[model samples]
Target: MKILRKERGGHMLDSKLIRNNPESVKKGLKVRQGDSSLVDKFLAVDEEWRKVTIEVEELQAKRNKVSDEIAEMKKNKQDASRIITQMKEVSARIKELTDKQKESETAAQKIALEMPNLPHLSVPEGMDSRDNREVRTHGKKPSFKFQPKAHDELGRNLGILNFEQAAKISGARFVVYHGLGAQLERALINFMLDLHTKEHGYQEVMTPVLVNAKSMTGTGQLPKFEEDLFATRDDNFYLIPTAEVSVTNLHADEILEGEKLPVKYACYSPCFRREAGSYGKDVKGIIRQHQFNKVELVKFVQPDKSYDELEKLTKDAESVLQKLGLAYRVVELSTGDLGFSSAKTYDIEVWFPSENQYREISSCSNFESFQARRAGIRFRSNPKAKPEFIHTLNGSGLAVGRTFAAILENFQLEDGSVEIPKVLQPYLGGQKKLEA
Candidate 1:
């Protein structure tokens, strides 16, 4: 129950549907970037599994009848030796059938968990981020009077950022933030937490940075993407890649009453990722790091209201940039580009002056019931009502390091100084700028 078993809706694909009309599963599989013929392979194995289950059921019933007869003969002082031997034979057959049924079911479940969540009907059809449709753009992209320095150079000149020391100690994709640089990252964390908790009605939480394997699986990050995780040998604990993994699993194996259909949490954690798949990408900057701070937003809501909740979630994340006067754009992810557990997603990209383009700062997604099904998160409409999977949603209100980098590149002045946004001035003790 802590992880996922006894597959139900949301986490479990409709195996019954596939058995009845494999064409249905085949059609839906393509929407998830799956092989269309996978259904055929699944059905072939499941068909044998069904047969074994039925055989086990029939043998078990026969053994029950024989046991009843033996009891009656014993009471009557009659010989029951022959009946006892027959019962043993029936028991053996039942055990064999049971094992066969289990093997088939285990394989089917493995395949099912590997499949990605189905795309929402409204999502555009295409492959990767390149095909993501632009939904909206916000604020104004700043134009520098002189060519703007990249964030790394800007921070280096100001004596606040050091990749050399970071690499000497921790290897690549790590950084050491000093003085104002460290303060800026801290300020962004507090600013985001306060905004989300006070104005956006989120309950702030500080979740653990290391979690058990089951917790990782509950949020759909295991068995499929294990390579991306950093695990400890002592107890199979993993360094959390995001607060979303810890926060979302808070209600795992829980049942909420109808009145509490919507629950929101704003969590802060220093995320860790191996960057396993990115060999040469963002190799020199904080964009892809071994560890970074982030303020995460997570929600649980009724299935019917999940999409509406997604729009609100996206805007809530955008508000962070808005307050800081950072320009950005939002793009709706296509089916092929969707995350493993998300049905629909919106990527918020902040404009970086040095790069001359926007880069993703947050990805807000509505997982429908996909994660709930996996995590055993459910709610009952009433005391007498049946429990149903609740919808899950999450987003990065903003990544702290990315925000820090954006500020440095966007606000760099010609005099080797960086201007601080007015909203963050109070957080930085009314400091005006970081000067060399």
Candidate 2:
């Protein structure tokens, strides 16, 4: 891997950004170092291509000269057959070189696009999510007088969640929400979206669930994470894993004004994840599933304000759990455990009393310009000034499915009824309790 020299400019294009830019990718090979060998290989291939091109061009020039000579010879009543044979040979050689050059260029492009982005300076280096760091805790964990029941047991006993029937209809990892369970999930979505839009000042948006490959890659979900997606063969569109993909890509290829520095958006959508590698984890409940509802918040801001914005964003997500009276904690993901696109991340984990442990329910990340560069989201300080990539940040206001699960497990009484939180009662049509 060549470590490309860091060029001094108002904008700093990282490896992912350069890979997405054809011209930058070609130029990056000449400077960067981590992947210098790959760059050298690509350069060697390019040099060979240039040599072949020059050779082909020279051969064509010679063939043209020979044709003119052959014409003169014919006009002078002399033999011209030898020149014609040589021209045919030159044309064949040119075709071969052209084909080889085309193959080399295609191979280079594939390799370039497949490379992952480098970890940001602030990101902690780790291999997986388990290596994440615990940042802080919020609200106290509930202590039950009686033995607590898992969400699945409580939900089944209360006649609210039906996993068996859902499997019968849609296969495994799916659940049917009934009675208050269904209403609770719906209320959470509406509640989160309303809070972000009305109080948080985020614009409410609804984006397409199906998007192109570029949209996925722009959000750091492609090339390496392709296995975690569900794709359609027709036009190659994938079902979005979260509304983040659509909302973040809203300004894809567009430049905005600096006055709009902190552009905020809130969205609610059904997310789909293949969960390809997780065969048994969280298989008992909606914690890890194929389809789940989520309310997402995304923002675009000046680079200098990103970290501050990250804290606010995490608080914004925490507010939802707080309002619901759910016991949860904030964990700062370590360098080794952060997602590919995130420079830094904070995971909000809600307590599940039955499991006697906190489980992740929301993830908020400050990607800086990682997603913006790929999505071509930029901003200009002045009308005539050049545009630069804006920093991108996103967090789950709350995962509706998990919120529903947490409420069921944590609020269940000895009698098997679940009490609705005061804040959610209005959205639940004033229902005070979920009784079987």
- What value does the lDDT take at residue 350 in candidate 2? 98
Best by the lDDT measure: 1
Please report the candidate that would top TM-score against the real structure: 1
Worst 10 residues of 1 by lDDT: 1-10
The models' CA-based lDDT, in order, is 0.87, 0.80
lDDT of 1 by residue, 152-186 (tens): 99999999999999999999999999998999999
Off by over 4 Å in 2: 1-108
For candidate 2, the 10 contiguous residues with the lowest summed lDDT are: 1-10
Q: Per-candidate TM vs. native?
A: 0.93, 0.80
Residue-level lDDT of model 2, residues 268-295, one tens digit each, is 9999999998998888977888999999
For each of the candidates, give the backbone clash count: 0, 19
